[model samples]
Target: MSQAPGLGIPGILHTLREYLVFYSGLGLLAGVSLLWSVLALPLRLVLPRRWRKQTGRWVITMGFRMYLRALSIMGACHFDLKALDTLRGESPMIIAPNHPSLLDALMVISRSPNLACIMKSELVDNVFFGAGARLAGYIRNDSLRSMICLAVEDLRRGSHLLLFPEGTRSNRLPIGTVRGSIALIAKEARVPIQTVFIETESAFLTKGWPFFRKPSMPIHYRIRLGQRFDPPTDVRGFTVELERYFQSALAEARLPPLSSMGARAP
Candidate 1:
């Protein structure tokens, strides 16, 4: 439950050591990613455009899984992702999750191969991620109208779309303010929205949280599926209610259930 720890000199050494491994692993993965992206370029020229997109997405999905697993093997983090894997139904619904850390997208996308997300316009031009993202047909968050249209079309085509309604990582506990775009996407697409809860014991990689100042080793992360809802006709009201649900979820997650609180006979 402690977001940050104060562990004097030992803490500083651990932080530095963990960050060294983190950056080294990140660099290695980035190189592999770049290579994969460049190699996929030929598929664009040879295969049908649609087939190329699918293949590119598959590559991205595999890469993500490998990257996360490598981090786990390196003793950087461990994940509780069983609940998230169960949410991967065949239906094309919106995946709305709270953004606690930068790795949230990687965690979600690794499990859903058919998922495309709304990413920052800058990433589309990023040297390492841009090529892969473009080849995978990920949407950019530049123009709202275009983004909505693309998202709806993707859903109609049976592709799952992931959205972080908060728009950015949480700056405080109990999640941050949710945006209306998620509701708008659901209403326009007429698809259900599935909420996913990402619980982390540490605030590493959160907004303004220094990446090098790592938390305790093998940082714990858990993904539990929240309630799924059909898009209501009232977009504004639905958005407000959605935000409230996430707030309650965070609060409830912090408390023990009544059944668990009772004494047990030995």
Candidate 2:
């Protein structure tokens, strides 16, 4: 007997399997993450200052990587990265990437081991990322001076610090303005800035979206690391230069500028 004209049983079964795996993984991750956070709280409060924070961050980061791997195994998404060698075991460096999606932060951390980030003040209160963020000693984005100081100190202590120069997610379709804060931190710490750009086609986990929808098509990410440049002594000049560099990179990637989408400069 001939098969039906539409999707075959095998195809349908495959699709359903993929979906089940994706959602199930997400659910499992949520449950385990909650338990981990709760357990870490008391340890965070009772353990010695240094060890407590370090242990807590490691737990969160390792958990995050496992979650990402689960998603990859489900074939929900994939990433293409260039210049991976540059990031291997590099520390005392300010690694900056364009912020286009909420997942960008996780992507960066997953790629770089022993990495800390400059996160927003609101993240400090967020249940999902807050506890771990505090334990990791992520620099709060609210205070420029304080954040810079913290970043410099992290670098001094041999920790890699990742930053999003745009400060927030891009409102535009493409690249966003490069805030001067990153440049300032680089200069103050006397470190070179390692630039990275990420391009993703998945709209499921976007800038402000809360719901998860499986994409009709597979999502792909293109991540490239640009050459490191010495921080410019001329702060304003460096900002303009970095902004143009980001714009050009996005353009080359065939993506739109964040400014075109009404994204404000940070």
Candidate 3:
């Protein structure tokens, strides 16, 4: 009999490994979220307001850390996130980064335990994720003034604000236009912006990507710490400069394509 292209022992084993890693990644994410939901309910009732938010943030961080660890152990992904550890000793500030994939937030959160993320209103109201996010005191991005006030409060409470300056993922390469929310929050809170650059080669979870789609194995992701911008006095000017900075910084990064339209702004 003739030899088949992908029917050999090693090829079959490779295919099996990919499937195992892919599904396990999905399952682990849901597994952690569901587990957190169950645990958050009673904790909310028992703990005080401050304690609840603190505990919620800690547990979410640990859960994400473990999930990423599982993926690493399974040879499914490589995470170079050590750059974020240097910020542990720093004071509360906005942790700004480019949103490349859905995993962008996951990567940052897994490393920084005290980050208060800005979530979309709908996601904050999601049944599966709402409980934990609500309990964690994550800021919602529906109302501008409310979002800014809550973000400043979180910073005042000594939690790093996790803000994606792009506001959403870049549909094309390099980056999308940076929004003013980051600068405004920093100015109002009097906190600096700790810029982070997340570089990845996979398109697994970019905007509009399929939920259950399987990607290639051993996806490599690297995060680099960028310039720290002072609390801006000029929101509009800072927003313009911020976009230019991202355009210059990520000019060489291998960002995944978020859409097939080929570089149209959202």
Candidate 4:
């Protein structure tokens, strides 16, 4: 008797299908990002100094939006945003958010306009985005002292910057720990830090997990902007006060509190 046509097709066909889908998704993401990055380069020279700043911000925002779109398209992940209305058009403010997923930066940038980010040195050196980041003038993560100074100057010039108080992505469920750097920056800049929290259900997109597998679903995010805390005359005193403010805010937000994290006074 002749062997059934379907007898051995399942194994080989399944493997080939998975590989094709995976590589095709990768190629599509890379191609689109390259085009977006190339198109954004000219704005650097065409725009005026003041306009240059805004244009640079737009590039970063667009890059992030593209990244999110690619994720949604390839991984079948849906994006759900909440409480963005509170942050729209707000500037010269220090944005503090709880870091839970790798995509937190993308989400924040995608929603905000003309916002500067405090990024790690490694990302600045990344082949994919280093060129764009340099052109955009993102504050380097190294040299905390210098970064603090730059942040203060940016705020004075009516520019907004984002800071992850945790200083890194959290590994725990609720949140890991918040660094004192944010509190110090708020104090020195004499501005308020807008607190936010993000929550997601997909393990693939969770902190430190970037690989896409098994079509993902829409993930939920919760963003909270707490009442602003004015800077105190004494910078050291202000740091303590601000840290306490964040701790309380986190607690109220139903996330992990930072009181036990031992935030240092400036």
C-alpha lDDT score of every prediction, in listed order = 0.80, 0.72, 0.86, 0.64
Q: Give all TM-scores, in the order shown.
A: 0.87, 0.83, 0.93, 0.72
For residues 1-266, could you state the per-residue lDDT of candidate 3 as single tens digits?
A: 12223778988888887888799889888877987887887888889886888888888888889889999899888999999999985798999999888888889988888889999999888766788998898889999899999999889878899999988877766788788889999999999998899998888778777778777778889999999999999999999998889889988887876656434764
- What clash pairs does model 3 have? none
Model 3 CA lDDT for position 168: 80
lDDT of 4: 0.64
Residue-wise C-alpha lDDT for candidate 1, range 1-266, written one tens digit per residue: 32334699877776787778778777877898788768766766788887866877888888888988888888788887878777666688999988877889989988888888899999888877887887888999999999999999999999999999988776555667788889999998889999998877666677766655546566778888989999768989998999889988888563211112221222
Top candidate by TM-score: 3
In model 2, the number of clashes is 5
lDDT of candidate 2 vs native?
A: 0.72
Worst 10 residues of 3 by lDDT: 1-10
Better-scoring candidate (TM-score), 1 or 3: 3
Global fold similarity of model 3 (TM-score): 0.93
Residue-by-residue lDDT tens digits, candidate 4, 115-222: 778899988776566556656667887998988887778877777788887788665535555566776777777777776766454454455453554322333445
